[model samples]
Target: MSRTSHITRTTGETGVDVQVGLDGSERTVEVATGVGFFDHMLHQLGKHGGFDLRINVKGDLHIDSHHTMEDTAIALGQAFAEALGDRRGVVRFADASVPLDEVLARSVVDLSGRPYMVHDEPVELAPMIGTDYPTSMTRHILESFAYHARICLHVSVLRAANPGQKPDAHHVVEAQFKSLARALKYATRIEGEDIPSTKGVL
Candidate 1:
C-alpha cells in the first residue's frame, strides 16, 4: 500500500499546493513560498524526515508572511491526514529532540483524532527572520498544522541562548521544524495491523 496525498487550497489571501508521501524516500522535495527563510525551514522537513514533500504557495507578500504560512500549513496538514487515512498500524506517538548550534528544541506528537497543541517557546525574538517572515508567527503556523492535521502536538525550546546572550531566532525556529519533522516521521511509520489507540480508532 502506498501512502500519498495531494492538496490544493485557495483563499483570498493565498493559494497553496502540497504533495506528500509518507514512505517515499526516492521521491523529491520541491518548496517555494517566496519567504526565503521559511522555505529553508520546510526543506528541513523534507531532508531530515526522509519523506517526499512538495509545496508551492502564492500569497500576499506585500502584507506579510502570515497568509503564506497559514495556508501552507492548512494544505499540508490536510494532505497529511488524507495520506494517513485510518491512522492504523502506525506508531501513533513519538518525540524528538534536536539541537542546532545555540538552540535545542523538542517535539512530541500523538496521532490522535483530536487536535491540540502546547507550544512553549517563551523567549523574545528579533521580530522578523527576513523581509516577510515574522518571528512571532512560528507558533501560529504550527497551531494551524496541528488543527488541520488533527494531531496532538507539543513543542518546546528546552535550552537556548548562553548565559546573558540573546537567542538566535533563526536557530530557535529551525530546530523546532527539524524536531517536528523527525517526530512526525516516527509517529506515522507503519508498525502493526491494528490501530494503536485503546479506543480502536484514531
Candidate 2:
C-alpha cells in the first residue's frame, strides 16, 4: 500500500506546502518554516515517526508566529489524513512515553476518524522559547493537528524532575513531539489486510 500525500494551503496570512509518506523507510525530512525552533520540533516528528516528510511555509511573520504555526499544523494534519486513505490494515491505536532530561511526556493516539484532543502540561515554561516561538503554542499545535487529522489524541507531561523549578521549554516540547511521533509510528503500522475497526471503517 502506498501511503503518501501532498497538500498545499494558502491564505492571506500564510502559504504552506506539505508532503508525507507514512510507509516510507528513509526517514527523510526537510522543513523550512522561518521559525527555527518549530522547524527543529518538526524534524523530530518525522525522524522518530520513521516518515518521509517535507514542509515549506511562508507566513506573515512580521505580525507573529501564530498564523504560520497554526497553518502548518493544519496542513500537516490534512496531509496525514489523506495519506492514511481508509486506514486499512493499520494498527489504529498506540501510546508512548518519552523523557528528555528533566521532563517526561506521554502520548496516546487513536486513528478512529474522530477528532478529539486532550493536552495537559503541568509545568510552567518561559513565555517564549526564543524571540519568536511562544511556549504556549506547543499545545495548540497538537490540538490543531489532532482536530484536522480526525484523530483522538491525548498528551500530558507526566513527570518533571526539576526539584521545584520550572521545566525547560525545549525539553518539554521535545519530549511531547518524541512521544507523539512514537505513538503515530505504532498506530500507522500495518498489521493485517483488514481495517482495524469494528464498524468496518475508521
lDDT for each of the candidates? 0.91, 0.93
The clash count of every prediction, one per candidate, is 0, 0
Q: Relative to the unseen true structure, what is the C-alpha lDDT of residue 41 in candidate 1, on a scale of 0 to 100?
A: 89
Alpha-carbon RMSD to native, per candidate: 0.9, 0.9
Q: What lDDT tens digits, residue by residue, belong to model 2 across residues 74-180?
A: 99999999999999999999999999988999999999999999999864677898889998999899999999899999999988657878778888888999999
lDDT of model 2 at position 119: 92
TM-score of candidate 1 on Cα atoms, chains taken together: 0.97
lDDT of 1: 0.91
Instruction: Tell me how many residue pairs clash in candidate 2.
Output: 0
Q: What are the per-residue Cα lDDT tens digits for candidate 1 across 1-202?
A: 7889999998999999999998976668899999999899889988888789999999998988888998998888899999999998999999999999978999999999799999988558888887877888899989999998999999999988888999899889999999999999999999889989889998
| Candidate 2 residue spans exceeding 4 A from truth | none
